[model samples]
Target chain A: MHELSIAQSVVEAVEKELESQPGALLRKIGLRIGELSGVDPDSLRFSWECLTRETGFEGVALVIETRAWQRRCPPCDIVFAVSDYQTVCPQCGTRETEHAGGNELDIAYLELETP
Target chain B: MTQIPMERKVLGENDRIAAALREEFHRRGIFCLNLISSPGAGKTLLLEKTLEGFAPDRRVAVLTGDIQTDNDARRLARYGFPVQQITTAGACHLDARMIERHLANWDLSTIGLLLIENVGNLVCPTSYDLGEDAKVVILSVAEGDDKPLKYPGIFHRAELLVLSKIDLLPYVPFDIAAARDNARKVNPAIEIVELSSTTGAGLDAWRAWLDRRAVH
Candidate 1:
């Protein structure tokens, strides 16, 4: 699975973001993953564990929040959650609804302690 | 522990690299496309057919990736154009870094169309952007019609869905209508092109689709 690669990238990004703060103890990291982002949260956590084992980043916890697929209809001016993979706007039967999200993968927050 | 509200993208490094590649492509007037599919979904064959149709002087090149062999590159290079193979070792997908590395030696200014055949796993490839103008996902009739529904990630992200090996539709249990419908259910705006690299059927439409997108 590519989750290992993803986990490595995420860890690297966090490490880079924390580089300026000397002796910053990164205690936890929060992730917001979309359903259609092609990342499995559980698998990512496992990968994170494998990457952090015995490293200086050991014992760092991971928090994940998942987002569902969404669609927004311009004419109806309504945002709707997608169900059963249906993207059509429920309000106006609009077929041109834009994909609002369901593919965003971001780091929501980082819990750390400065030594 | 203090919780700092980061709201940063985890794959920001990859995104930054892809953004740079996109800028370089745009600056060089290059039209790039990333082709993704499951293993044995006729990606290499489709590229073979596509490369065959190009004129000898056409400023088009290909970069094909696989977990191990250079066989795909060998196959595509038979058309007398520049084709390179990226062996990812065990990686299931090709990230922007792999693409940037392989493209280091190429004269991008002379290239107008650059086609990248990603490592053949639909799921992982969908997550990595290669700075292409569009993503094209290919599925063959040999695979189930429910493939699009099963792997909605790539289907939703791709701009065009190329339905390959359509000539085998009569021999197989694959339903073309159902496949198209499932793809549309996930992505209403995804374009579909049905073709067979073997019998040369529907290749014109595929070529035309490329022609329309390969703006100089």
Candidate 2:
């Protein structure tokens, strides 16, 4: 599954970040995934668990924040949340809309213990 | 116990490599296209047909991705164009790093058109950008017309939508009008092309579209 690869990337990112603090222990990772990001959170967590076993960061917690998909109508200038990948504007009933937000996949923060 | 505010994108690595690839492609005057679709969507067959239509003067190369086999590369190589296959080894999608690594020895300057056929998938590949000039998603008539609505992520990001296997329309219950409407709902600016590679029907229009996009 792609989640496994994504989990690997997450671990690699954390490892790179921890490289600066040689003896630091990773406590938690904060992630923000958008609805349109195409990442399944449950699968990611499962993959992360499978990957971290027996490693130094085995018990590290993963906190995920999901963002809703939003779109903005150019004519009406109304921003609204969208579900089921609907792109039409609710306010103006027009298809001339642009993505406003919720396509982000970011590592917002990390908790670590310094040695 | 202390929280560090990294504020970094998780896919930053892939994005960085994609940006560099985009720059390199533009510098070489190469029009690169990324084709994405589900398994058994006839992506390889369509590519073979497209390659046949290219003029001998036009320089074209293809890079295909698969989970474990080099079969696609072998198939396209018969066209006599430079072909490279990236065996993802079970990775569902192709990242920019993979493309960069595969093209390490390629002479991009001589290629007028570069086609990257992504691993046959409808979901994960939509999230990764491979630094292509345009992304095309293929949907065959046999797969039903609800695919556009069912898998909107790929359709939303694609510049063009190609409906393949039109020759099977008489054998299947597919509503072309409904499919077009659904795709338009997801992406208002998307261009649609319907073709049956088996009969060479609509192949000329497809070639014309490629000819317009391929950089000389």
True contacts kept of each: 0.88, 0.79
Residue B81 lDDT, candidate 1, scale 0-100:
92
lDDT of each: 0.92, 0.88
TM-score list, all predictions: 0.98, 0.95
TM-score for chain A as predicted in candidate 2: 0.87
- Output the worst ten-in-a-row residue range by lDDT, candidate 1 chain B: B1-10
Output candidate 1 Cα RMSD: 1.0
Candidate 1, residues B71-100: lDDT per residue as tens digits?
A: 999999999999999999999999999989
Model 1: clashing residue pairs? none
Report the C-alpha lDDT of model 2 over B1-216, residue by residue, as the tens digit.
Answer: 789998888878898999999998898888999999999999999999988876766689999999998999999998889999999887899999999999887887788788999999998998898999999999999997988877777887898899999999999999999999888877788999999999999887778777776744
By DockQ, who's the top model here?
Answer: 1
